[model samples]
Target: MSFREKMLWVAFIAMIGGFGFYFLTLLTPIGQNASPDYYLGLLFFIIGLTIGSMLVATLILFIRNRSEVTFKEDERDRNIHKAATQIAYYPLLLGVWGSGALFHNGVSTSIMLNILLAVLVGAESIRLGYQIFLYRQA
Candidate 1:
């Protein structure tokens, strides 16, 4: 497998783990009360861990296989990414609109932020899934 494919698998696992933690956190009393501090902290933690892990994983991959570490994407990879990103764009736009609606409706900041975070997760899931699909096809 190419490094990109392996990285996609890593990213997929990370995203799934993050989303699971998100929903799990939301089911807690903090989520019930819409505690902005707790929810936002979790969001930050997930983002940090995802980024940190990817970087670490890349470093590890490079260390393990110094010769096979190809960083450049071919045309297919670029097309797959562009298409997947285009697919994810609608959810983001809708999420922004939903966030605005929540604000206009006087919804709690916690809830609005949760929705925004959900949007991020949804977009990421789509992108990762599509990328994996394309990778599998190749």
Candidate 2:
């Protein structure tokens, strides 16, 4: 598989793993009563896992195929990225708007943070999914 395709697989796996962690965390009473810091920490943890996964995948791909490693993007790549991002945006916007409404109604910061986290992760997962789909469309 190509490097980008491998990275997409890594991202998708990390996203699923993060969600699993989130759900597992939510099973605890402490998680049920989330503080803003708790959500932020979770967000950081999820992001760290995702970026770390991509970085490790990149390193492995580079080592495995040093001469084949490429950092080039052509029109198809650009178009796929743009289209995926646009496809991901609407849900993210809606999530943010929902968070805004909740905040206006005096909802807790933790809740808002969770909403934002969900939006960020969900959007990223969709973007990556779209990219993978496009890559496999050949």
Candidate 3:
């Protein structure tokens, strides 16, 4: 696989694993409580875990393929990224608008925050997935 594709795969897995654990934790009985400290800690942990894993994975990949790393982002890669980002934009817009509506309806801050986070994760997942698919096809 190309370096870019490999990086995308790593990002996709990291995001799903990190956020999947986060959301699952939130669904548990204990998570129903709006304890600001606990939520903040968990959020920070997940963010750290996601970013740390991505950085480490990227470093390893770069080490393993130093040559490929230097020549990253060809025309085809750029095109695929552009297409994926454009496609993912729709879900992001929808999610933001929906979150605004929820806010107007006086939803809890925690719920709105989760919704926004979910939207961001979903958009990123879509972008990475589409790029991977395009990479494989090409």
Give the whole-model CA lDDT for all candidates, comma-separated: 0.82, 0.80, 0.92
Q: TM-score-based ranking, best first?
A: 3, 1, 2
Best by lDDT: 3
Q: Give the TM-score of candidate 3.
A: 0.95
Candidate order by decreasing lDDT: 3, 1, 2
Which digits, one per residue and each the tens of the lDDT, describe model 1 over residues 1-138? 878777888888888886778778788886777756777787788889878887888788778866667568889889989988988889888988888988899997777777787788888888888888888887
Off by over 4 Å in 1: none
Model 3 C-alpha lDDT per residue in residues 61-95, reported as the tens digit of each score: 98999988888567888899999999999999999
TM-score of each: 0.83, 0.83, 0.95
Best by TM-score: 3
lDDT of 2: 0.80
Alpha-carbon RMSD, each predicted model: 2.1, 2.3, 1.0
For residue 133, give model 3's deviation from the true position in Å: 1.0
The sequence of per-residue lDDT tens digits that candidate 2 reaches over residues 1-138 is 677777778878878787768867866898888765776678678778867877887788779877656668778878989989999999889988988998999987666666777788888889999889989995
